[model samples]
Target chain A: MKRRTFLKLATATTMSTLAAPYVHAQEKKFAGITLRFGGWGGLYDETIQKYVAAPLEERTGLKVQITAGTQSADLVKLVANKENPPFDVYQADSAYMVEALKADLIQEVTEAEVPNIKRILPGFREYGEYGVPYSVFTYIPIYNSELVEQPLTTYTDLTRPDLEGRVALPAATFDTWSLYLLALAEENGGSISNMEPAYSLLEQAKSNILALAQSTVAMIQMFETKEASAGVISDARGHELRTKGHPIVSVYPPQGIYGATSYMNVVKNAKHPEAAFAFLDQMLSDEGMLGLPRALRLGVTTDVKLPDEIAKDLTFNTPERIALKKKVDWQKWMADRSARIERINKILRG
Target chain B: MRYDFTDYVLIVAGAVTRVAVYALLALPAALVVVLSFTSGETMDFPPAGFSMQWYQKAFESEPFMSALWTSTYVAVIVAIAALVIGFAAAFAINRFDFPGKGLLQALAFSPLIVPAVVLGIGLLYLFAWMNLIQTMFPLFAGHLVLAIPYVVRTVLASLTLHNRVLEEAAMNLRASPLRVVRRITLPLILPGLLSAAIFAFVTSFGNVTVSVFLTYGGNVTLPVQLFTYLDHSYNPLVAAVSSIMIFVTLAVILTIERLIGAETLS
Candidate 1:
C-alpha cells in the first residue's frame, strides 16, 4: 500500500476509536439527517464545527449546518416563520431569550430531552425551560495596567477624572451597552426596576469618556491604540484582548459581576427534534463543555474539569464566582427599552 | 501669491481638514490591507512585522471560500437578472406614456427610501407567508429587489441619451421594429447596461442587513460573513479576509472591464 493511504487509514481508525463511547443509540437513529443551526458567527462557528459538530456527525451520521447570524436577527427570522422555523436549533443571549420565550418562538426543553441539564449550575438555571445555558460570560471593568495607576473596582471608577479622555464606552446603539448598563445599575444602588441612579452616574462620567465606540471592534481598537485605557467589557473579550498582547486586567468588583449568558434553544416546530436534543446534550457533555470555553475564554455551564491555566481565567460555574454574578430580570429590562435607551443616549451623547 | 498671517492660517487649516477627512475615510481600509500582511497574531495597525501566512490561512479555510463563491455567484446572477428586468421596464417607460407612469417610476425608486433593516424584515415576513423561507429564493429575491432600482434608473438615463434619429432612420428604411431595437437601441445603450450591471453587483455583493435576514441553511454572502465575524471576535484573520474580499471585488470589476472594453467602465 502507498504511504499516504496507510497514514489516512491509521488516522481514521484512531479518530473512530476515540469517538466510540459518544456514539449513543439516539445518534444512530438520527443517522444521515442534516440538522440546521443558527449560531453566533466567527470563531464560535469554527469552534462548534470543530468540537460539537464533528463529534456529533461522526457518532450519528448527522450533518450540522450552522447559519451565521446575530441572536436578535435569529429571533426576527423565527418570528417571521414561527410555524416553520429555518433551523432546528439556534443561539440566543440573555436579553433576547426572554423575547424568544414570550413570543413562543422556541419550545420548552425537558430534563429528559437534554439529560445534561442536571449538570448545569443552579445560578444559570433561571431560563432552563426555554433553552440551555451552554456558556456564561460576564461584563467587568477592564483597564490598561500600564495606564491605570489604580485598578478599577467598579463602574464608578471608570468616571474618575484621572482617566478622563482615556476611557471608551459602547455607543447607545451597540447591543452590549445594555449588559454594561445593568452592572452600573446594580453597583450604583439601583435595580432593574429603577435605572435613574445609573443614569445619574453616567451623566457625571460624560466628561471622562473619550469616545463612544460604535461596535465591539471599535472598542477593542480603542484599547489597542491606548485611546481607551479603561472601559467596561465582557470577561471573554478582556481575556481575548489580553491574549492578543493588550496590557489590560479584568477586575471583578466587590459587589458582583453582571452575567451575559448565551443559551442554545430548539426552535418551535424544529424540523429535527431528536438531532437537536442530541446536539444540545453533547454541548453540555465534558468534552463539549471544554470546546466552547476553550475557544472564547467563557465559563462553561456544566461542571467540567478545566485545565489549570483556563480555570484561573474563567469566572463562572464555581461557588464564589457564581455568587458574584448578578443577573438582571430581562423581562423588566426589555419593557420600555426604547425610552430607557433614549434617556441613556441623552446622558452619554451629552 | 504673498499671503497675510490670517490667510496662511486659513490655508493651513483648510489643508489640515482635507487631510484629516481623507485619512478618516481611507485609513481603516488601508490599515486592514496592512494588517493582512502582519506576522503577529492580532490585528495590529502598524503591524508587528510582515508575513503572508494569514493570506495562506485564508485560502485554506472552507467557510470563507464558500462564502466568497456564494457572494460572487449571487451578485453575478442579481446583476444579470436586474439588467433584463430593468431593460424591459426602462424601455417601456421611456418610449410610452402610460396612465401611472409617474407612480410606476416612484414605486421603482422606493426601495432606496426605505431603510434596509425594515425592508429586510418586511421581505422576511413576505417570503415566509409565501412559504418560500428555507430555500435560497428569499436571498436572491431580496437582493434582486434592492438591485432593480439602480438598474432601472441607469437604463432609463441611457435610453434618454440615445439618438432617436438612428432608430427612426432604421424604421424609415424597410427594417422591422425588432431589428431597429436589436441593432440600434441595444448597441447604443451597452455602456449604460454595463454601468447598471456594475451597480446591481455592488448593491448585492456589499449587502449585509438584508442578507442577514435572508440567509438559508449555511448559505451566507461575504459581507454578512464579515459583519457577523466582527461581532464575536477580533483577529488578524478578519483583516486578511477583508483584504481578500477587496481583491475579489476588484477582480470582478476588472474582469468585466476586460470583457466589455475599458470604455464600458469610463
Candidate 2:
C-alpha cells in the first residue's frame, strides 16, 4: 500500500539486526582475559563452575580458572599474595569478609560495575561495597521428627530431659558453633560480649549431648545413624537431609535464628579487574543467584522469588523471616572466638 | 588330643582374638566398598540398593579425575626420589662411621615425630619465603620429606638384617666400591628396596595434612580433594572414590607382588 514506508521499515529491521550482534560483541569485550577465582570446593565449586563460570565464559569469551580451598586456607593465600593477588575474585564467609576488609585484601564495588547488586535483598546488602552477598543460610535446630516427640521451638529445648544422650553439638572449630553459641547467649540473657550465661547453660546441657560434631556432615551422620535426635545445623543441610528422606526438619526458634551469609569480593590487586567485575556481576544476576539454590539447596541472597517448593525450605526469604534472623557483631565475636571456644570446651569436658 | 580346662580356654581365647583383629581390620574397608555401590543418594550402612552410578559419577567428575592424576604423578615422583636418597643414606650410615652420623639419622626420622600440621605450616612459610608457594614444588618437596623417612627406616632395617660378608668379599676381589654396591649390596637389599618404594608411594599418595597446606591453584591431591568434598557433602560419591583408590592400591600391590614375589615384602 505504501512503497516508501515498506522500504523504511525493511531498512530499519536490517539495521537493528546488524546492530544486535554489534552490541553483543561489545559486551564480550573482555575476551582474551583470564580471571582467576578462589572459593570453597565440593558442590559449591562445581555448581559455580557449571552454572556461573561456564556460562559467563561462553557469553563474554573470558576464561575463568577456579582454585578451591578451605576458608582459612583461602584467606591465607589472599594474605600471602596481597601485593600481587593470586585471585581476581575471592569467596569468603561473612566472618572472614570482615578480616579481608580490615586487611584491605578486597576492593569495593558500585552498582555501575555490578548492576545486579541492586537486586539483592535489602537486609543482606549491609556489607557495603567491600563484598557482595551471594547466599544466606541460618544455623538452627534440626531434629529427627520421629525421635523428637515435643515440637522443638528454641535452642533451650536441647536441654530438655527427653533429649538426654540424644543431642549433638557442633565442635568449637566449626563456624556454626560460634553462631550456636551466640544464639544460646541471646536465649540465656547474655550478649555476644558476655557469653557467661551461654557457657553455663551449655555446661548444664552437656549430659544431654551425644557428641560435639566436627562438621555439619558429622551432625548429619549423627542424625542418620540415630546417634542423636537433634542438633544445630544449617537450613541447607536440613533441606538436604529431608530431601534424602531422613525425617529431619529445621526449626526456626522463637528467640531468633542465627543467620550466616557467604560473600564474593574482588581482590585489591586483581590481575584482570574488568573480567573479575564481569564475573562478579554475573554472580549477582538472576541466573547467578539461582545457581546456589538449584545446585546445593542453598538460600539465595537476591530478592528474586524462587519456586514455592524451594522457598518453603529456605529460612530468610520473606520480610517476616528476614526480621527473625538475629544480627551479631561479627567483628566482636570473631575477636573473642578463641576465648569463647575455650570456655565452651571446658564446660563440655566438665 | 586331650586338653585341660586352662589349655582349652587359652585356645578359644586366641581364636577369638585373631578373629576380632581380622574383623577390625577388614570391616571398615568392606563397608566402604559396599556403600559405594548404593543406589541411594546418602551414605548409609546396609545400603538401600546396589548400583554402580556412584562409580560413574566419580569417574565423570573433573575435579576428582584431575586430583587423581595429580596424586599419581606426585606419588610416582616422590617414590623414586625418596628411594634414591634413602638408599644412599642407608648405605652410607650402615657402611661408614662418619661424624654427626647420629644427627643425620635423627634428622632423617624427625619428620616421623613432628606433627604433620607443624611440618605443613613450616613448609608453607619456607615456601612462601622462597617465593615458591604458588607452584607444585612445595607439594613435591613436602611429600618427599614425609616419604623419605619410611624409605630410610625400611632400608636401614634391611641393611641391619642382611650380612655384609658378600659386599666385603666383592670389594676384596678388586671390584670397585660402586661395583660392590651394585653387584652385592643392592641385590641383597632389593626386596627391602621394593617394599620401601611401595611404602613411599602409598604414603605420598594418601598424604593429607601436608598436602592441604601445600596445595595451590588447582594442584590439589586426591586425599585433599576428598577431605574438602567431605566438608561440603557426605554422599556415596566419596565412598566410590575411596573404593577406586583401594582397588588401585590393591592392584598396584598385587602387580608388584607378582613381579617381585610376596616373600620380598615380608
Which candidate wins on DockQ? 1
Q: For each candidate, what is chain B's TM-score?
A: 0.89, 0.96
lDDT comparing candidate 1 with the true structure: 0.85
DockQ list for all candidates: 0.73, 0.55
Model 1 lDDT per residue over B111-217, tens place: 99999999999999999999999999999999999999999999999999878998998899979999998999998999898889989998999999999999988
Which pairs of residues collide in candidate 1? none
lDDT of 2: 0.85
Could you give candidate 1's per-residue lDDT for residues A239-317 as a string of tens digits? 8888878898988887887766788889889999988999999888988889877888888887788888788888764
> What's the distance in Å from true for residue B236, model 2?
0.9
TM-score of each: 0.91, 0.94
lDDT of each: 0.85, 0.85
